[model samples]
Target: MSTIQRPSRPCKECQRRKLRCDAQQPKCGLCQRARVPCEASPAGKRGPKRGHLDALRNRLVQLEETLQNRLDSEQHPQEHAQALHYSPGSTDASQSTDFLRGDVGYGDPLPQAFMLPGPSMAGDADTLGLGPFPFPDLAVSLPQIDRGTHAELDQLYFDRVHPSFPILHKRRYLNWSKSTAKSRSQTCLQQVMWILATLLSTQSRDLINPLYSRVKQDIDLIIMDTGPCQLELVQAWTLLTVCELMRALYGQAWASAGRMFRLLQGLRYHEIDSPRKDPVASEGMIDPIRTEEKRRVFWMAFLIDHLLSIRNRWPICTRLPISDHAFQAAQLGSSTFLSQAVTEPPSSDTCSFNECIIIATLSGRGLLRDVHGTISEAYGGSGQIHIDHDEWLNLVLATRNQALRQRNDSDRMGTFAQILGQVTEILFCKSLMTMNKNSSTESCTQEYRCRVLRAAEKIVLFAADLTALHFSMVHPFMFIPLFVTAEFLYENRALGDGAFLTQLRSLVDVFGQLTNVNDHERSYLDLLSRSCQQNIAIMPATTCVELKRIARDFLEALEDPNDPTKAQAVASADLSVTHESYPSTEGLEQFLSGWAKAKQFMPNFRMELVDMVAEVDASGSGGKVWVFSKVTGGGGGTDRDSIDMMSINGEGKVWKTKDVQRITSKH
Candidate 1:
């Protein structure tokens, strides 16, 4: 250099002395003065060392190798099953080091073809393999269940799940699943469907945990990366909601259902009756099968929204249209709802799906849950504290009857529908009973109690039929109905005949069967069963028989309700309606007075026992309850139901004054 520019970096000797560098490099003042040999350069390199890229490259190489193995396995997928479905492998967290770093899983000996590797990031992120969504790794994490396990699951799904929920088209889905190729969204669908199948098949947390966790981890990324307009995505989301419910992930289930509903709105599925050329009409070309699928898909979301509301008593995401015809048509096409839903469509069992819709709508409209302050406001309700009980009962029965009219010759779907319909009726009946517990007449209270018992019994018997047929045929939603029935039975067990505890325990046994699928159900079942066993009281056979005798005699006394003298003679010993004049059945006593009053107000009144409950007393003290469905003569067949509960002390042989509770005016 011309003047030997002063070196900016210090020499080794200067650094050791912690002094400034001199103008020259060969000899420095600090080294010379300290009598230390000076080094030519500094102790370290000119710049900081870089070890990050090296470590990253090593990781990249590992991923590439594992991906290559997966690729090789995918080519020969039939040979992929080197071991049985997830061979008993160690799931111990301490052995996690043995786990793969990708979607293959923690400790499962899963087939390598489950996961496929995405393209490596090139020079630019814009050119990444993920189409229109720069998330190159989103689709890669999806794990396609192995062919063998998938085949088993496919059979299981169509055989068991499909009968209850026939949302997917069978032949098309089977063909698609069998093929080696699937789009990004279809891949997502496969993964979620597999997750549901796994949960339904095995109770082993070992298998469910890994697959479920992987889906949960990658599914959000896929949904976010691949925007949610696809029908397959909607189906996947719905299935995921079911999965969350099975595992008792309530919060997550709610969120998943909510997201799916929004996706549905985005796809414009909610505009069922819109005049505009909506998403279904693409440039004046309509796909019939696809359109039917869209309707089923929308109805599926509708079903979930209502189920969520029913299960937790929460506000539904999408409010039902005020129009009944529109709502029913939207649920199942007008033609389908009329022909298939009511009569039996050769094409599909839409009645089952419509039946579920009916229950969902009933729960919200009937206001079964205690938390209806906000929900009431949404649907033009007065948002008042006291619900109009008559209006509530009317809505309930109307919905129930409409759903009941849905007939399927095949019980595969019909059984589930019947169970749900009865379950809903039971829920509404219980709510009515609870509302009128103390302030109302004993007879009125007992009428609702009888209704509750009848509905509960029907549900248990239907579930019994399902169990007998095959538990797999039961809907996944059956779990909710089962719990609801069990709880209602226990709460109102004292209202039953001598068979009170018998019915309750029958449902308890069904609860235990849920353990065959998983243990979560057993936890709640134990709590309910324990409570029932500890507190439940069974009515005595004598009291039940006596009450039945009293009911029969009362009906016999009023055999000619039209005749005044016969009505007056109801309490006579000759009539045998009440054997002992000292302890007369109140039903017999009220006959003359009610008939006389009926003649006074509206002439020629006719009455019969539409429904009856013999034993209303848990102490077996002999309390009589009967539900009289009133039919007004000469008035165009106006059908209505009422309850006349009579309080009688069998032990003391004394009659107490009771009032009539008119439950519903008309169906």
Candidate 2:
């Protein structure tokens, strides 16, 4: 009975082309001629189209209904008995509520207010084949260590790991451990501590996977439940991240770091207020110990986030949100506490490990923040950023001085800080090199190269000394220095400097110790060792003597004849270089041309004549116009034969040169 709608006008394309249309079924005659399909205008809508507003309105209505239902259930549970029914496995409601409020309970379910997903509905056939959802079973059983073993591991952690991190309050933690039965949070922490201690003390991965999985599972449950992000929870997760990093599970470590970052944010730890004035604490209760602990935990999170950001090449997440005054106030408060503790009358059993750790942490934080800021400023601009060489050098020197001071004052902790400082210098130098590589106005100069090589040498010698001292329970931070030094040595081996080759061998030896604990370490060692072997394969016989000597020293240091890889490196080093030969003047010219094209020729390019040869025709009518010989004279470790020959056309032009085995004979 309704009037029919009229057809719409033709499409814009046909109109634009000024084409006449017979407006056929799917195509017009003009469009058909042009081999383009005709598309008609869409029919006009009678009303406005549905869009985001409509969807939002629908969602709001559903939420309103849900709220109404929830209120009704609260008012009269009998009205929605089936909906509010508790499963047999669920804990008492009061217990769940108390646990949600952060009271100690192991079996309580998360409060309903948190809005976590419930267990799968058995009565619903829709989700029958999807399998059980994660986090339904929050219960986890952890492996228990004996009392003696626990104490030993705790001591091990304090002795080795605590000096570097020092976030945990040993006395308070020990007292708490003795006073209370283990809670879920405490259990998770214990597992993490044990895993770290074992790794540091034994350098063994026997307990790593199982313990790591257990802690991970617990963390997942806590996150899913939207549980209170307590300090203990934060510490547990932070340690878990460290453990992941130690195992070279970078992706997993990064994920853990992200979660830790969010957890700290949820706790408002980044607000940077004096702990005594923390708004989240009770109105009148200002527990200085708790305040200090919170500050320590926050700083730890900041440090971890910064390191992860650098490692992952992502933007840092721990940017201070509060004013400078607040940050200084927080730092000052911690420093005051540390100073008071250290200046107190010393007992025979008193240990200043805690104070040393706090000072070192504070110093390291300041240094790292400065480095991060400098780098960000250097690279944050739109165009090319030119580094002030003097300014850069001063910064490096200052960092080095700080590290040396840290190293000179204390024992292992100082040593740790010292190594970190050295690594910082190496990182800065590397940054400069990278900037130079990418700079339009500036290129890598000899001075910068020398700085990098010097930094690398320092790192290598320090690592070698540390390894020789058997202080090889090396922390995760040390890995960067080791890896970077190896990379620098490998890439610059063409310099033909015996010292560079020697350091490279030493780095390889240091890596051998690390390979047993991490797959990444093992992989890196293998790759670098192979690279060294490859360089050795093409090295000139004249340069082989020093490299062979270095290789023998490294092999002897290994003290294990069964290590096939080290033995193979020794054998590769022992390979005799074949006789060298020099090319004719024509070949030299050809080499120069190719070298220019490759951009391999530097301003200081030096060519050493290793060999020369000449041949004459039997009739003596044709002179020696072509020559082939080996030459090695680049700063970077390239050694190859080259060909020099005169033009076959007899134009009498300059001699031409090409790389070994590349150019073919024309006649």
Highest TM-score: give the candidate number. 1
Instruction: Provide the overall lDDT of each model, using Cα atoms, as 2-decimal numbers.
Output: 0.52, 0.48
Please provide the root mean square deviation of candidate 2 (C-alpha atoms, Å).
27.7
- Per-residue lDDT, model 2, residue 497, is 49
What is candidate 2's lDDT per residue for 1-667, written digit by digit as tens? Answer: 4543325575534543333344565566666765655566555556533453665576567667655654444554343444434354564677556644555322233344333333333334222222222221223323334466668877888777765566677766776664457666777787788787777654434556677777876666555444545577778888888788776677788788877766664455543353534355632145545555666676666656544433222222221222123332443232333333323432222223332333343334444544665767678743333346436444545544453554363444445445554555555555555556656644454456666667566666666556433232455455544664566665666553455655665565555434333442232343333333244322211122222223323323224433435533333322221212332322222433433443334334333222223332242112223333343444354554455442111111111223334222232
Candidate 2, overall lDDT? Answer: 0.48
Model 1 steric clash total = 1
Q: Please list the residue runs of candidate 2 whose C-alpha ends up more than 4 Å from where it truly belongs after superposition.
A: 1-144, 178-180, 203-207, 274-285, 310-382, 386-393, 396-410, 434-444, 470-473, 495-501, 513-667
On lDDT, the candidate that comes out on top is 1
**Residue pairs whose backbone atoms clash in candidate 1:** 443-645
lDDT tens readout by residue for model 1, 171-276: 5676688766776566667666766666565422344665666556555645534122456767887878877776667778887887677566545555443444
Model 1 lDDT-worst window of ten: 113-122
